[model samples]
Target chain A: MSHSSPASSEISFVQHHDDGTFKKTVRKVTIILSVVTIIELLCGLAIFKLGHGSHMAVLMIKGLVTILSLAKAFYITSYFMHLGDEIRNFIMTIIVPLLLFVWFIAAFLIDGSSWRELKNTAAGSKPATEQVEKAVAPGDKK
Target chain B: MSSAAIPAGTKWWSGGKSPFNLSYGKMMMWYFLMSDAFTFGAFLIAYGTTRFSANYWPDPNHVFDSAPFIHGGAPLVFVSIMTFILIVSSVTMVLAVHEGHNMNRKGVEKYMLWTILGGLAFLGCQAWEWTHLLTGDNPVLVNGEIVEMATTVKVNPWGEVVPGMMHNGHQVTTPGPVAFGGFFFGITGFHGFHVLSGVVINIIMYIKTRLGHFDQRGHYEMIEKAGLYWHFVDLVWVFVFLCFYLI
Candidate 1:
């Protein structure tokens, strides 16, 4: 396999060429990713500098940041990982399950929030009084 | 039999080349990375749920307000620099992979070295941030007196008492701070470990390229595989940035 053979030429997806297209592509990707990141940073700063204002405003800023982040993720995955050049089926094999992963997160978060609410109400009603009384009893003895 | 069916010399299920038109190793790497993405996703979602459920959460602006040389408060400046470093390193890794495809051993060596340095620099920045979190003065204004506090899994000085809650029938004395610190440290620490491993792998690849190993092999698929891992690490960081730093 180490020996140089004409057959090995067929293995690579991109034929080695003297043309600098590969270099140019890499440079373009770097610029795009960097610009997106800088935009995200600026958005974060702008939120703080401009002040959060209303809850809705803060949420909108966060939504913008998430959108920027997802854009960066797409570029890195497709270009850097070479998924863009892979076969359509191969891309789906990776991407389709990842969509499921996102769904898993959304489902679990909803469940977690419900649990949090249950815990909060439980603490608010019974545990809060019991713990405070327990504390007061100890203080009286001391 | 149909003309497309069973060519005599080639067994129908024989594993010769990639059926999926990808190398076996690369396919397996993709599978591993996809699973890893789910792990990070779960962590981030847990962080989000816990944070939103809480009444009072740490203000990211106040909590992450520290830069490298500048004193006082500069929200997210340092983390932004770290993000830039990782993105730049991903670019270098992709360039190295491109050079690998071209069988340019020297190009691969140079870019791999740069990527390794970027990883190290990011790790160093994380170390500084962690130290700052542990030791820096975080004074919370309580009853008009500034009470100094540090971040711990059990307690956090970043915000008010996490609304008291119950978990599995046990009462939580401190809710919000504990969960916040736990998730912050846990998720970021896991990501930092990935960065460390990526650096180590890049160092090995760099040494091999310098030794003409890939040149002798007549192909640079090894470097491409390593590039896949590096790119995946960078991808994970994008989400981590959104979950931890920005949001």
Candidate 2:
């Protein structure tokens, strides 16, 4: 029962602790992730069926999938990466970069949407009839 | 009179004291994982933004249905198998590290060899999937018509898909669209690269175990470190599968 004495044999490399519970924890995480993944796939399939071609539905489903995927990513990072045993500051270090990335993505989205709007407006006012009329007139004169 | 009383030589980063009794090699692997984490994060975020910007993205079921001799092909089945393989490999890696800790050399070799095999198998599957995707085995609709697909590499973040890269359904098309192959290659290609690298590392460790490097060290921190890397590879694949196949 004394904790001070060390084992002398070659097979005593591992600390004399039972890893049964550790294995259980790993199994639990695996099951949880697998279930979550199945749910995500189902949702993805259903959304395509229920909301095909509807822009709003598309946006909503896409957002849901992204969030769920991020959740799975975090679970794997935290548990499988051993970040759960690491210091809180280390976890924050990993997380802060992700926040900065979200900021970058937001900027990109703003730029993209504004550019789309600008393009739409530029072509929005052109009348098919008038444009055809002008083209035909120029051809007729020629 | 006690050797344990004497202060040990400490490294600069570790303050001349070994934190967690870890070696330089192990510590370096940790930092590598951290930085690698950032790299994969950026790739995933970029993928999200690209998906958001695209007016319409193909559904995974429609994109990944490749059955050699089946009808109503689906995405979940093949990708799910890939996911299962990766996860099982990760478990084998953990068991290898555990066996290494126990000084069970034979156990370590057995598990590590299995882990290496798993990694190789995963890489092979990924390569097959990529060829199938790039060559247009799966169906992709272009311009609102269910026309045959074509892909070409053009300038992009990862690489360009020029016109005539692939042809499908009787349509000769140029690189489909910029984001199409871009995201596909960017996300999965990166993960595949990690798996390939992991296979190499695991093989090295497997050979070293055969050579009795770990037994002399009295610890298997090397195995633990390799486990860390291998797990990261598997973890990244989870995200990639979700993004590319499910989400």
Candidate 3:
């Protein structure tokens, strides 16, 4: 129950920690996260300055900000969550599942774009209804 | 204490103790956070898909332009403040966890108080933003009439910019993609809920710390687990800020 107790045989490692260095790393990570967030904010402002018409330039900047945001996420999860100092196999268990997002984002965006294309090109569809129609009972409708 | 009782060849993975070199509680917390990440990921991805489905989506710059007490405010100013607030809270939380490790109950209490204050500040900002958006009138040309509208779950007024109509210095716009308002409120409201719960958890942790609960337990690992949840909140905000405010 106390720090004075010897390293228990139940746990494998004898943790050797220095108070000063731990605080130092905390400070370093905090500053890094702040700077990265500032850069992201600047990118947002740049997008505003570039205006709406320059599609390519605006897209590029948005991509940059997205990457920077990912970096910020990494810092928070790794340092603030202390996952970086955790054992290797434990870290893998967390990181490996997150990789699922790559395919998840891609598939949704792709299909969404495709559906838009289909909707716009189909001219034979009935005009959009202005009022909702009541649903028919299963066997009552002719 | 029983190191000699075990067979000499017994490996960590052979199951006498945690192979992860961590407590079950911390490992379970990690798994919980991973699942939470997927939840937010699905929300954001759904938002993106909805965005792609629409031809005339609202630009975030125009939509988030106003700040409190600043008429005709600049873009990204207020939201940046919100982001920084969450970030600062996260830092305080990590410090609290560190104090817990060192068995400094006073230090932990101090940092926990600061973290709670930060969470409440962030919530207050969110409340104002939501209120302003919900009640502030912006004129829109609907059915050949300039009808006033506010951003709501069912409607968005920051549509494609209309050519030449203005009322009280607010631009008239065609109705935007309805899902824009839906996603904005739904996702942010969800994130705010997480922040709310995190604050509550931190409060409980603080009260227990005040009562010497962690001291009795001896490890302060409870504080570490709560710290993980708090940082996860901050981590989600990073992406939420990107999805709603910046891009």
**Which candidate ranks first by DockQ, i.e. highest?**
3
Which parts of model 2 are misplaced by more than 4 Å? A1-17, A51-61, A123-142, B1-15, B18-23, B137-148, B152-175
Error of 1 at A1 (Å): 20
TM-score on alpha carbons, each prediction: 0.82, 0.74, 0.91
What fraction of the native interface does candidate 2 get right in terms of contacts? Answer: 0.18
lDDT string for model 2 (B158-198, tens) is 12223444444232322234776777777788888888888
Residue range B1-247, candidate 3, lDDT tens digits: 0112333564877675777766777788999999999999999999999888777788788888889877555899899899989989998998898788778999999999999999999999999999989997889989989988999998879888887778778778988888988899999999999999999999999999999997887667788888999999999999999998888
lDDT of 2 by residue, A1-142 (tens): 1221122221111233346755786787788777877777777676657645676876677688778767777667666655655434445655676577667768766765664454456464454434453345545664
- Among the numbered candidates, top TM-score falls to 3
* Residue range A69-137, candidate 1, lDDT tens digits: 888888888778878767566677888887886777678778777766866785645764553433455
Residue B242, candidate 3: Cα error in Å is 0.6
Which candidate's lDDT is highest? 3
| TM-score sort, best first | 3, 1, 2
Query: Lowest-scoring 10 consecutive residues by lDDT in candidate 3 chain B?
Result: B1-10
The better-scoring model by DockQ among 2 and 3 is 3
Per-model interface RMSD values are: 7.0, 8.6, 6.0
Model 2, position B223, has a per-residue lDDT of 82
Candidate 3 — which pairs collide? Answer: none
